[model samples]
Target: MNKRMTGVMAAGAAVITLCASSALAAAGRESSADMRGVSVLVGGGVEGYTRGLGADIQPGAAYGATVILRPTKVVGLELGYAGASNNFDRSNVAVSEATRGPDVMRNGGQAVATLGLTASPVQPYLLAGLGISRYNVRATAAGFQDDTVGNVPLGGGLRVHLGHFTADARINYNVLVDQQLATDLPSTSATSSTGGIYTGTVNLGSTF
Candidate 1:
């Protein structure tokens, strides 16, 4: 395991610990105008990016859930899980030239805090959070084992609420961990990755 992964896991544990304590205290209170009491979010979206020798990178669909604990009417803490896989087509490569480039899969968790502007028909909101992503890349080239990478995402999104359900769109930029990409491959060297780590997602969920 890489040290970056260890740090990510540690941060996730800390978020869980803090949210657990908050959830317990919030549970004793009744749902009111100022608080949601409890909510569960379920949604899916696309992810796109590439590294090394892939020109056409396929977008991957991801599904995840977020459990929310509302301490105040407008403030909430959420923990979420998301995962996806991507495959890219490679051309004009010396070593893996005969074969397609690689297929990659990533899984990770996020911790966020949401501030609801208004909990009404049009509930626009803002979210800020820290995310940890673990990615495994496998190339078709022989002697190239799967590469595991980790990254942190920082960004926000907008949400609109309707009754028990809500729709939202968010954009986040991923900062890949340095050590993960510093390693080299046989045919190619991991210099820098192309495409923006920026990801856009649309989601829907219900409050319980």
Candidate 2:
């Protein structure tokens, strides 16, 4: 990763830690009715690529589920799983017009620490996490291999609570370390070991 991206991730982590500490301390003074204990959400959206991955891949569909555990009104922990399938750029790869290139599927899981900005029905939050992503190439080509990379996810979102149900819209920028995609394909030029994945999702679920 570049120095700028590394600095951003470090700053975000510091902010999340500070906010979490404040929220946990304030939780004891808040009323019990304001607490949200747990929730689960399932949804689908879209994901785009950046840096090295963007050179040979096209944006596509994404789906995922998330489980949130909140110990206080303003602090929570999120566990999430996401999968995406993107088509390869035919012009960049050595594939003919009659046959499209292989599908690039990415599956990942994350554990994030969240801090809500407010205690209202509509709340905005910040999150930072660590994750592992597996990139699989689904093609008939020989000598191809799959790769797994560690990632740092940093982003924020908005959550709206309606009675016992909640709706959330979020976006995350995943900074991938040691990611290698399309390296085995002929005529491919993306050689950078670091890349990024940009994801946007909306989820709906019940709160407990």
Candidate 3:
């Protein structure tokens, strides 16, 4: 695995560790409020790489896990890890080209503030989060380093609770954050990648 993939895995592992630690900490609490409990969910789904990396990447396999801490009936804290693998190939041979581009992956982590709409078995919630993404790119292309960019995820989802099990469907629109001009593939001067990542996935989980 390359550094990009390593970084992605590291970030994801870190999030999982944090979640475990938080759950342990919460386990010692004496709160009787179910709304103030800790919950962990594991699931996998497909993601659409609608506009990632200059806009054109196609949909790919996406899967992730998340941990939630609800402090109140209407508010919660969530940390998640999402990863998608795609066949990444782009070229601008007229000026420059990414000759070794293919099968590049995208990995990301998110920290969001979740607001629940109701306390019923069927609930809807909105989530807004800040996330960082690492792209696994081909290194043969000079001056083309794998990008680690920040992004904002804005979306909401619906959740159905039955007993201790839950099912969820969410769609998030990723707005790739802007950055200063960094590099030029053909060593002309500099350029920036302005695009976005969008995803829609379903998850199945249970509360403990």
Model 2 poorest ten-residue lDDT run: 185-194
**Candidate 2 ranges beyond 4 A from true positions:** 1-35, 96-102, 140-144, 184-193
Clashing pairs in 2: none
Off by over 4 Å in 3: 1-36, 50-55, 89-102, 138-144, 179-193
Clashing pairs in 3: 92-96
* lDDT of candidate 1 over 61-156, digit per residue (tens): 556777888775568798988777666543422235343433666678888887877644334457767666666655453323344444556666
lDDT of each: 0.54, 0.69, 0.60
Best-to-worst ranking by lDDT: 2, 3, 1
TM-score, one value per model: 0.61, 0.74, 0.66
lDDT for 197 (candidate 1): 52
**Candidate 3 lowest-lDDT run of ten:** 180-189
Which digits, one per residue and each the tens of the lDDT, describe model 2 over residues 1-208?
Answer: 3343344445444543444444445544334233487999887667777765676667777789999998877898989998988776666654433335437788989899989999865578999999998888775333334788777889998776655666677778887765645454332223324357887766778789
Model 3 scores a C-alpha lDDT of: 0.60
Superpose all Cα atoms of candidate 3 onto the true structure and report the RMSD in Å to 1 decimal. Answer: 10.4
- Which residue pairs in candidate 1 have backbone atoms (N, alpha carbon, C) closer than 3 angstroms, thus clashing? 34-73
Compared with the true structure, the alpha-carbon lDDT of candidate 2 equals: 0.69
